[model samples]
Target: MRRSFKISFLLIVMMICVLSGKCRAGDRFIRNSAFKGDRQIIVTFAGPVSDVWANDISNFTVNEKPDPDIMLEIEDSTLSLDKTSLVFTFKDPLNREVPHCLTLKQIIADGRSQGTATVTLRKNYLAHLFSVFLGAVLIQNFVFVKYLGLCVFLGVSQKKSTAVGMGITFTIVIVFASMLSWFLYRFVLKPYHLDFLQVIVFIGLVSLTVQGIDTVLRKVNPALFKSFGVYLVLVISSCIILAVPLMLAANDYDMFESLMLSLGAGVGFLLALFLMASVRERLELANVPTPFRGMPIAFIITGLFALSFMGFSGMSLF
Candidate 1:
């Protein structure tokens, strides 16, 4: 009986080893590929794997270069168990237009051996910047697309000069406020789980920023302030001003991206204001029915502008 039991135990161990080997052989495959930013490349596997061997510099190649560049460092590589992903952060930004290939040879994950997985990095910062700019100015436009800041858009856009001033002011304020709000949300409220206070905090921040700008403008350019100071103060209540920080916070954009978005939004607002001011100026001379002369005609023109901006939809730089 003892001899038979020992033989059975050895047979079971051998079967287990074979099964494990087969499992490892069949499970090696790439799941997805993406970029963290302009530099870091993330490659995910279908199954979990040991990153110890995979992180080696010799195991990876970029652009099929036979001789690796001295600038490329292996220490920048990282592995995440939670997502079953390997991250390779390049020391510098890769060329945007060129198609770059990253090849992983003899990579092992979840005790399974993967032969080779190659991922092409096609995303670039310029494309991303253009996308952001296009999206903000056209697709998700602050005034026409989103219908935000209508109060100032219609009120201040009565004249080309006022429209220009308001556009500049809105751009400056939006950029500064969005950046400051990002820092506050990322570093303070988010870490402490004080998200409930976001609205109050954002409103307060925007009000203070507008007030600060108003104070400075009053001192620096009294004539300009006298002309547009009321509108600047009124911006404290402008939905666009408040919406910028809120949108940035909600989207969880980084500092640079938030700034880009703010600038885009500002420029879009400026464009809308300028366009509307120009149209209204022309409308003054056109013969129109008395019933549709002022506000009605203005609304119709605004709607037309909105429709025209819609043509930019589905347009992307990437």
Candidate 2:
């Protein structure tokens, strides 16, 4: 037992070191020996930071004097986790170069003043966007991978028509949830340093957005709302819808990539829903065990659908 404990302790220590190394590897630091003051310094980050913090943490001391012209700030954090890249902006906006360490130091000093730290910027655009899209659709898919919102996935997938409608609704809700969450995170919570309130704020946002969407749909098209609103309730407070955006916002994906991720996730949800619905409808006519009539068969069908989506691996449509 003692030997086992020692082994476990060593493993924990090694893991901690590895994690700490990764965390510190992103620190924005520049040594004076590497300084080339003549050239414009471009720094890109792979994490989160604020403009005020960037200005504060990023310092410039040229010949031991504060270098005003050397300061740099975030151009944007919108990045694709799959296929994204950053284009460095120079004093001449048209001129671009690879980001280096010096610029990062300037950003860190800037962020320090603003009470923020280095935020990671996307290094490769195309790869990151593609990675994000694929990850959402496959690795962390809302349906098969994360198994979130299964209630709606199974409940509304009874007919192809209903499935499509639910899919469309799901997409819209997810996108809206992402947008609202991003806004609340950046504007409301972060400002007050109440970052822990993310969960509460997001839940509030989702409920309010769903309610608003439901009200609008009822006012505009009562029949559509009547038919799909039931399913909407099932999805109304889903964490998946809000979680994706919160994650994207935290990681600082650009607008387009965020949209793409939401879209891909919606698609994955639709795909699962449609497949399950088709299987369940067919099962209704087939001889199913009495014990496994409704939910049991539906669950079995979902399992099969999940298995099938797994086959989509190693295939890239985009």
Candidate 3:
């Protein structure tokens, strides 16, 4: 029994490795390939290539995906002086979010060897995910740039402790709910032609997630839970939480992308809340005009924060 169990475990692990795309079995002639910037491919060969074969445009083909049908137009194909590398420049920028396939045909290398092979090219997958994460956190911040989640942004930002606590809780809820929404959209609704029911379905998922969190938090740490107060209930309908799921569905983001985006949005909202709390805390001490003491001054300060956050727009990670 033990031996059988071990064998089963090993089999499962191997299957996972293959499914995760870690198993690349390309020919040795194709030493390596990588995406250069976003529009070019840098392929290193096992040996120096013949200049004649390397320059022919027909010798190389680029496709958007593994499917042979969706080919990209190559504007130029140049061989490095050493002839061990080929640089393929495309007419348009490659989509960083999707993997591209490159095929080499009748390629003579080292003045003798000739072969054909295909390689999968993509921006470092983890790097792409990081770019997506950072873009969501800073570049596309919901609170400051998209004008989202202001209700909680204003309601809980009065005290640093409150703001920070709400931020943490909101992060947990948003990530969990977004993933659940993605699963349902990708598997259930999309397959069944029920896309129209997404909004109503997501609302239920959010409410369910918030309810579960509310119950668990009420038990594990009542202080933090009580600190949440009515705002915990408000998360069910918070524009920030709801928007993440809708964005995931609309953009057709994969599981990792959905997670990064939801997580980034949560963290951005937290930053917004903390900053407001800090400023508001200082304002409580400083002398202020009677008319603009509370929410009024807070709004003006928030506008300034939004303006500062606009500086992040220049960052284009994708």
What's the lDDT for all of these models? 0.77, 0.60, 0.85
Per-residue lDDT tens digits of candidate 3, residues 1-318? 896899688657645733575555467788899888868889998888899988889888888774579789999999999889889899999876677888888678656646678788777778888988898888889999999888778888999988888888888899989988987897799999999999999999999999988887888888877777556776765698999999999988777778899999989988889999999999889998999988889899999999999998867665
Number of the top TM-score candidate? 3
Give candidate 3's whole-model lDDT: 0.85
RMSD of each: 20.0, 18.0, 5.1
TM-score of every model versus the real structure:
0.64, 0.57, 0.80
Residue 114 of candidate 1: its Cα lDDT? 68
Summed backbone clashes in each candidate are: 3, 56, 0
Ranking of all candidate structures by their lDDT, best first = 3, 1, 2
Quote the lDDT for 191 in model 2.
Answer: 79
Q: Give the per-residue lDDT digits (tens) of candidate 1, residues 199-233.
A: 99998888888888788889989998887786777
Between candidates 1 and 3, the one scoring higher on lDDT is: 3
Question: Higher TM-score: candidate 2 or 3?
Answer: 3
Cα error of candidate 3 at position 28, Å: 6.0
Error of 2 at 161 (Å): 2.1
Least accurate 10 contiguous residues by lDDT in model 2: 30-39
What's model 1's lDDT at 252?
Answer: 71
